[model samples]
Target: MAAVDQNSLRKLVEGQLLRLEGNAFQDCMDRLGLVLYPGDYQPVRAAGPKGDTKNDGYCPKARVFFAAHATRGETFAKTKGKIRGDLEGCLQEHRDVKVWRFLTNDTLPGEVDQFIDNTLRPLYPDVTIEVWGLKTLADEISKLKQGQVERIIDVITVDEPEFEVVVLNHMKTGRDLWPVLSNCLGWLPHEEPHDCTDDEQDLIDSAVQSFRDWSDISGDIEFSRFSVRDAQRSITAILEELAEKRLGLYAATTDDYPLTGGPSPFLGTVAIFRIVRVASE
Candidate 1:
């Protein structure tokens, strides 16, 4: 068998990631108790794409102005500048925007972290700026079960199950199907993501993805809730660990290394963490 092109596979994966990022972004916000009104990207327009008036979205629950940028091939530093520009534009144009929710396909880099902290937070002191980057996207994908991944693979990869049914029918009729089946099954020619025509792929992808995204109205709601809770826990863990170290450092502000340094009552609190880590190791 010929080796599949890694670059094509990557492009395919990135395409899917970007397309799904919006819903996943909404899911994360929902988990944080912010409910975005279902709508389009551009502001309240008379007619939305495909005759749908609701293409963009707004979060009344958080009073946020949401922006989705599924940038495929950009460094985080470049993306950060773009985001800063967009957020500045939003603030300049929309007086009602209380929170700036920026979602991107690129992972957040240290430059972006500094931008958010030293730039965004300080400059936009009156408004809240939240970013959902590639790591967040990965975490959302991680919550998808092995089963979910397989189900999607089954839907998009090939017509194996259909061919299996054909084999079963042949067996029932007691036909000599060895040569015929052998050639057909050989290499198990599969549908790569790029193989499907756009329309056909969209139909299959949407049906299968919808099955995963929305099993039923209730199941769909449950799936979103599960995603939200899972993401919240992941974010909380990172934030809490940072807060712990910062708290320790604050307690021993004068110490050379408050987190691992000269005596302070919070030192024992820090010590306990070290002991736990060593024990686990």
Candidate 2:
């Protein structure tokens, strides 16, 4: 596969969350124990493409706001305080708040952290307030990378258990299966196959070849074969130590159907299962 550009990848991840819908942003805030009121939380800014701020309407329910200069310490601190104050006023109006969450790419200064912890939190015991920095958001994005693969597994493993195994095998082929996969395998040479030994190398090679063959088939068909092929290749590589034993896998059934006029109809239902073995005498 083509090499991933780290800068581009970072932007891709950020793009997913640059301007979330107010409700979605509120949901995230709630999950992180951020405070919110029980009313319409609208955008304070104008309702056009981003950066078009000509309309001067008062956003009565502005749940999420992007601070412009988080890197500037003093300015960021003042802005955080101002935003926090606005949120506190909103809470006062509604009174039915669960939590208030702040999402940003920069860290809070020590004084600001202490102020929030010791002053604000105590004053509003009922409303929980939490902050998530860029590092935390990045970690969540990393998990999402794995989640995309798992979702494919879930879709493919809907009905038939045996077919799920096949789908899992397919998931192992996609490059960058996980953000950390490269980090884990970085020590090994790319040209050298994993495990080095004859039997292990054979199994790895077989998995890789299976993945390649299924690639085109996956595009033509609706089954989660492509995802499974990528996932399977990754799993196989990771579990090389257990090469001697037959691995068991499983997935749940799904209601989704494949699109028409693509390549081929998905052939069967897929389910997931795991294998447990007794010690041999």
Best by TM-score: 1
TM-score of each: 0.36, 0.35
lDDT of 2 by residue, 246-277 (tens): 42212122222221112332322212222222
Clashing pairs in 1: 39-55, 39-56, 40-55, 40-56, 41-56
Residue 136, candidate 1: how far off, in angstroms? 1.6
lDDT of 1 by residue, 80-137 (tens): 7777877876676556677787766666667777878898889888888887675554
Best by lDDT: 1
Residue 104, model 2: lDDT of: 57
- Cα lDDT of all candidates, in order? 0.40, 0.38
| True-structure lDDT of candidate 2 | 0.38
True-vs-predicted CA distance for residue 182, candidate 1, Å: 32
